[model samples]
Target: MSSSSKIRVIVVDDSALVRSLLAEIINRQPDMQCIGTANDPLVAREMIREMNPDVITLDVEMPRMDGIDFLGRLMRLRPMPVVMISTLTERGAEVTMRALELGAVDFVAKPRVGLASGLNELAAQIVDKIRVAAVAQVRRAPAASAGAIVHPHAGGAAAAAPVAASPLLGRLSTEKLVAIGASTGGTEAIREVLVHLPADAPAIVITQHMPPGFTTSFAARLNSLCQITVKEAVQGERILPGHAYIAPGGRQFALAKSGANYVAVVDDGPPVNRHKPSVEVLFKSVAAHVGRNAVGIMLTGMGADGAAAMREMKDAGSYNYVQDEASCIVFGMPREAIAHGAADEVLPLAQIAPALVARLRGAGDRVHHRI
Candidate 1:
């Protein structure tokens, strides 16, 4: 491809080695090129104004300006796709979550082990995310006060308590299960859905594509904001109403029935569709075990990983929903599910949770897909 046709990129990091490694990896891709490198957000700001690259790989920590703070500024002043490069520490994961809410496209966890070897091992992932970010729909965020730290659902459960307390869902809550799958923009999308569900809502099981060491923080982050209890799925635990179980990163999570109650099955299995905690695995189990008592949700993501399996869910008598194009960061997964004749309703990101809750309460119309 010609240089002009390539996806222009900027690398922003404090570490010289990381910057060099990322530049090399990006330049090696035929469809992308590293146009510049910045050691901090200040330099990056100048490069961005001059070059206006298609995407930027940003480090989560840096001098002169904190990465999250910079990202909030950039999104408000000049919105564009950004993929964060972060250390896989508990703190890093928390910051990464904040970055995503600030409108970053995605993130790559810098492995805790060998620096050079670890980055080399993630070459495919690094490039793949850049490709996704290139065409992703980006929006400017509302500007925040200087020195103010913005967090998703800043009010926590204390602020979320009265928002979704449904007294109408009684026996229906215990009888049904909600199966959800997402990737790419899933972090914010999943949060949008879970926060709208009441504490008495049906059991929700989710699979969001992520590497190990991230989901624990992800689940905890959600738990603080949503009315329903949220946690990483535990093996053989009875699935309870009003709780959401997130598939552990790097592991498979599926639904099963033990005697009179539903339980979670988590284990190390071969990667399905190149993802361990694949949506396909979780949706399929919901099809086999929950059957007509299940509701399937396919959110914003970048592949067809769960499309076919979600069709199995529809065939098995589950009502399903997929996020519509306008709200998706990458429409690949939802488009595929629509092509496969799955989704019963195609709703926007903000509408999905309310719609799902209505369906469970037997109050919504199903106006809905082929992959």
Candidate 2:
């Protein structure tokens, strides 16, 4: 294929070795071709105008202009898929979230220096992210003439409005809980959805592939911003209405009936789909305990972890939704679910949250009635 048809990539990093390594890895892939490298955002800005690569791999730390600021300008002026390379630290996590909010597609944790194993892991993640970035939809930054302000509330409202109009809106029945599963790009994707929900939205349970310490902080952040309560799930905790319970990383979370109510069960078990808080485990439990009284949403992530469980939930009569390929940062999970006939509706990311809430509020009635 010609270079124009190939997955053209630009590598931007302060470290020469890291940039060279990334370039080598990207060029090794048949579908991906590294077009150029830049030492900093200043050079990167010029290279972007020249190369117009399909994707960019950007380091978080750089001199003169930080990666975050460059990302903000790039997304506003010329949006394209970007994958942030960050260290595995609290600071790294914080900056990574900021990058996502600024419209970066995903992130890869930089390998720890001097560790062969770490570098190998980083190589694998970089390759995967490059592949995903190639196909991801790059939304154009709203034109300045559009009078778009980056107001947090307005940004959220703009993101939520389309979700409310989704086809899933008219397909639901009674108010039931929604269970969502994701990894990788999930932090920002989930935020976009949850921030749009009403204060009285139905109960929600989430399993995001993450480490132990991260989920708590993520849940806290979501709680602070969202109208509904969001918290880390604990064993034996009652499932309350309008509250979202996120499964802690490093453990499996399952739902079980306790008398007239449902409670969360956190347990130690072998990882499913190479994930601790497996979406399959949660969806299976929801299928058995909640039956038809649940909504399963498989968001953007890698792997087919949630496919079978979503099928189980759908077979049991629960409504199911998947983020469409065009809106997914990584389409693996949702693609699998849809291919397995598990998803009842596939919607764009911008429309998923409000669509979910509307389904929970009886807008789904029209769908079933039509059936």
Candidate 3:
């Protein structure tokens, strides 16, 4: 890409130190340039008008006006991609989740203490998120209903009840499981798929790149809107049908079999592909345990984290699908999966859930629907 094609970015944070650090890192990227910096949303508003950058990195907690409120207005009006800078604290996690719901593309967590040391260690992450944001779809978020609203500040747990699992649907010899992975624009993409699943859909396991304290609220938000139960995976819990288990942030979530029943195993492990609760880890586990019985879907994300494991799943006889490039916010992962010859089908975002449903239904015409 040419210099004229470099991604333009703006940094907005209350801390002068943070703003300078972010600008330095962004400017260092060959494909990106920090066009401006702001100490608060007030200044950011004006800078956005002047700079019209491709991406914005906003701090969650800031003086004058918070990032969440600014994000809401920005999405409704200008509709630009944004990556949130947040503290790695309980309160920070709660607010960051709210920002995602407000249409922020992604977020980075900073340490509350040792801000300088922590931010230094996160240089690569900071730049990578900005890069992803630059290409992410920046659409206005749907208005939140009272029922879908989650009061994360009040507590970390989601404010919804789990739906009762429906009796086993098909009579296959082995139980069916659905495993999905996503990053970047995943929060909304996952919601789009989950909302369309029926109450009797097969069990689902998801690994969405998110920080701890945010996954619970994400699951809760889905639980409120979807017909099926959505919750953070708990150690040793049975993977019941009609329920979706989201891999909890900051932990490795894998699947294991307890006799004929599949179960979730949440463990501590080093980050594979530079991510804890990595999509690669989850998909590989599903391949190892569920094999041909599982349905593997890799959605839009910024990297090739799950592509190899998706190949493994295919080798093990599981059906696989990759989100098509045209529908992806960032096509890296899905493109990698397709390149690996892992995908049995490549479908647009609107078609993935229904196609999966059709396959599981044993629709005789599914062969005609393959793209």
Candidate 4:
């Protein structure tokens, strides 16, 4: 392939080892090439100006402008796809959540130990992200909501306080449930849906393609911005209404029944469609267990991880929503779901929450109209 045909990438990290390793991995891909490497944001700024790469792998901490500040500036001036390289630590996870809010396409958590081999082991994920980032939708970052409203000390705050919960939809059918799935640019998309849901919304089970350690912080970040409580799902817990359960990274979470009540079944199952906490696993479970009582939503993501199972959802009488291409960072999954005739509604990202609310309210009216 011609040089111009390859995806151009810039590696930015404080550690020389990380920078070199990332560059090496990027170059090894036939479809991608690392054009430059920088030890800090100041150096990276110049590299970006001169090289104008398609994607950048950035570290969270740096000497001259930190990655967050650099990312904030970059997103405003010349919004471009960025894949963050974060350490697998609590602090690292917190900063990564902030980076995603700031418009990063995705992140790769570098192992805390054995940097070289760890990065090699993750090389497949690293290059795959670069491939996705090259085509991801990267708009300017929304202005900082934390700095203006709340102090930015610790525990990454939301862009702003959540809007008040919508009026309670009283006594939803005991069987009603919501199943959602996403990947690639899922963090923000998931947040957009969860924050707009009413506090009394039907029980929500979510599968956002994220690895171990990150989902904990991701759930916390969403919980801070959402009216409904959000937490990582645990094994065998009876799922409750008015809360959202996120499948833990490295585990599979599926909908099941415990007599009359719904429950979450988390397991150490192998990756389905190359993902644990796979959307297919969750959607298939919801299809068989919840059937017509469930609402399946396929949000912005890359590839067709759950398209077939989502069709199974529709065949089982579940109503489904797939995010439209224009509003998605990568339309692969939603497009595939729609192609499979799974989506009952194909809507933009911004309109999805409102549509879901309206659908639920309408369904409630139909169920209780005689009263």
- Which candidate gets the maximum TM-score versus the true structure? 4
What is the C-alpha local distance difference test score of candidate 4?
0.87
Please report how far candidate 3 places residue 223 from its true position, in Å. Answer: 2.1
lDDT tens digits, residues 46-118, model 4? 9999999999989999997889999988986888999999999999999998888778899999998999999
**Residue 50 miss distance in model 3 (angstroms):** 1.3
- Candidate 4 regions with alpha-carbon error over 4 angstroms: 145-168
User: lDDT ranking from best to worst?
Assistant: 1, 4, 3, 2
Error of 2 at 275 (Å): 3.5
**Clash-forming residue pairs, model 4:** none
lDDT of each: 0.88, 0.79, 0.83, 0.87
Task: Give the per-residue lDDT digits (tens) of candidate 3, residues 1-371.
Answer: 67689999999998999988888888888999988999999999999998888999999888999888888788767788899998877788778767876778889998878878888889998888887888775665544456564322112223333234343344441378899999877886787678777788889999998877778878887898888899999999999888999999999999988998998899999999988889999999999998988899998888899999999999999999889887777788999999999999999876777787767767323422552
CA-only RMSD, every prediction = 4.9, 5.3, 6.0, 3.5
Clashing pairs in 3: none
Deviation (Å) of 215 in candidate 3:
1.9
Q: Which is superior by lDDT, 1 or 3?
A: 1
Point out the worst 10-residue segment of candidate 1 by lDDT. 362-371
Clashes of each: 10, 6, 0, 0
Residue-level lDDT of model 1, residues 110-165, one tens digit each, is 88789999999999999999999999888777655553333232221111223447
Give the alpha carbon lDDT tens digit for every residue of 13-124 in model 2. 9999888778888887777898999999999999999878889999999999999989878887788889998777777777876677677877777656663456565676
**Weakest 10 consecutive residues of candidate 4 by summed lDDT:** 149-158
Better of 2 and 4 by TM-score: 4
